[model samples]
Target: MAEKEFENKVALVTGGSRGIGAAIALRFAGSGAEVFVNHRKGAGSSKAKAEELQERVALMGGRLTAVASDISSRSAVKEMMETIGREAGRLDFLILNAARAPFKPIERLLERELRDLIQVNYMGNIFCVQEALPLLEESAGKIVFISSLGSRFFNPAYPLGSMKAAMEAVVRDLAESLRPRRVTVNAVSGGIVKTDSYKVLRQHMENLDQLPEHLVVEAEEIADVTAFLCSPAARGICGQTIVCDRGMSNALQRF
Candidate 1:
């Protein structure tokens, strides 16, 4: 693809301050799309990381807008979409990558944790869709939710899996429901990627250290797949969760 394959396009990547979200934001910016990097408001580190990403993009002669908004708030999500519309005029891609939850078993979750799990992971994404629908419909946009292997295969102490599973269902429903409007929705369920969160996960899932090196998935690898999903090459695909696990999920031994 050309460097400017996505020139004149606009993309919003929620939770784009770090990890896989950061990678996706950079991917779109590198492809000549005006990118919005969304980080939670009041998160100093996250905001700083987003600024760093913005600087990096600027060095590449690309534009990246760092928007601070908490996806969990309906009002915040609406304002975010409005900001995008005002600044970019149109939105072509909405990447749902924000997630908040403790690394604990479902049984051990506190009421607040459970509320956050549902509100941020599941409902927060729904809020983004609801708010961005108008701008998306205007551009025949694409929505890609970031999911995980834990959603399908149970992982020890990973409470976010249930929300991932739920959102995958939404992906399918939205794909069909919004088909007439030409707005496609899909998901990317990544395998084990060594992001900052992996350090914490390693403490709970000892097996992560024992997994074969070849089974590890890189953040950039996931970004590449996401870019493809939004590209014309993926026109035939819709409402599907494309797994980027390096085939690790295919081997039963990993479980």
Candidate 2:
């Protein structure tokens, strides 16, 4: 119905089978980008969600391929990138949107659990970036990491917030290193979003009523900001964490 913004670009979105990742994949494809949608396990894992998205892309006359891989593994990430290079020729955008964690209290979290969190959320990101750097450099691409407000504020429900904080540091460091190469790196920290992940905390949604209707961020909203960051308009805006929390971050706290 409308002109697409990223007509010639090729994008790779990790964990894109559903929720925020799904929204990002659809948005990029809608904007005319050839997208590589990465997911782990089989289609049976997410069922019709992956097929639904693939069909949507086809209907829009956009190119997309859904691949399955465990990003926490270095060899898996390497093979994924190799496939993209061979098929897409070059990569123009990377969205690290996949993460895993178990809800537990800080003291209750096992050392093994912490290690798993680090591997999936932090180390997985590092591996993806490193493997994709060559193609990204060739295209002067944009890399967007999907973080959360938990990285900045205390969320007792999610003991894995510390890993998000670590990722914020990674974003800054990577941005600085990639500056000379013309590739931009940034993190999008979203507030409470309505997604399958949020279903676990739906009980708290009522407590958020005091905030604006828009304050409850949606997956698509995050997708929109992410797409903008990957565009030419965001070329000068690098090494920054853009908070898409609908001003929730600015509200004064009550004692």
Candidate 3:
């Protein structure tokens, strides 16, 4: 096997307590990245789950810390970034993964619901990038936004898709502006990964079964691409959204 590529490096993954986020955090830990796992509030963050993950990473001989913060709040993001600074001193990777949405059609969403969706999914990502920039500057870090197929395809039930698409645009802008600072930015647009979020999606989508088994990706598969985006080997790739859907987007129906 290969050596731990992330040895001695440090990373922060938002929504790191569960699903694709948890998988990403563990992959970083497995690669020897001291990870700051950020879990959000309400139905999002879970202290118990975070603690469990920390223990598992510890067993792997890697360090991991779980911090509960509302990514939609500037103050919370600041506090979390500050804590990482004091303890870790530097940050090598920022994984924008924490997100909240009603998992319903846009027409069914209330005004407040739409506002909250934008706040947590779009603005929250900006808050993390802005606050974590100092530490990222110190480490000349990398940022990987955990996007979804909804960003590109028609997912009327998935209200959060717009925000994901918006962030992908931001990645392109940031990639150019932050180039002088050597802080690369990118995104991973994942397929239908069987996560808790998927469970919610299932309630709204009638054609979930239309997807073939081969096209349905695993959480760890997305994690693998995320980790690669942070690796030295990906230095040349910037401002890009690497689609990891196993070709699910390539067709409508199969024989």
Clashing pairs in 3: none
TM-score of 1: 0.97
lDDT of 2 at 75: 98
> For model 1, which pairs clash?
none
CA shift of 76, model 3, Å = 0.3
Error of 3 at 216 (Å): 1.0
Q: What are the TM-scores, per candidate, against the unseen true structure? A: 0.97, 0.93, 0.96
In order, what is each prediction's RMSD in angstroms? Answer: 1.3, 2.2, 1.8
Cα displacement (angstroms), candidate 2, residue 208, comes to 5.7
lDDT of 3 by residue, 36-134 (tens): 999875343388889889999999888999999999999999999999999998999999999999978889999999899999999999999999998
Tens-digit lDDT track of model 1 for 1-255: 455889999999999989999999999999999999898965678778888999999999999999999999999999999999999999999999988889988999999999999999998999999999999999999999999988898877899999999999999999999999989999999999999899999999977899888888999999999999999999999999999999998877874
Q: List ranges where model 2 is wrong by over 4 Å.
A: 1-3, 203-212
lDDT of 2 at 99: 84
Top model number, lDDT? 1
Write the residue-wise lDDT of candidate 2 on 125-144 in tens digits. Answer: 89999999999999999999
Q: Any runs in candidate 1 off by more than 4 Å, and if so which?
A: 1-3
Looking at candidate 3, what is the lDDT of residue 236?
92
Locate the minimum summed-lDDT window of 10 residues in model 2. 202-211
RMSD of 3: 1.8
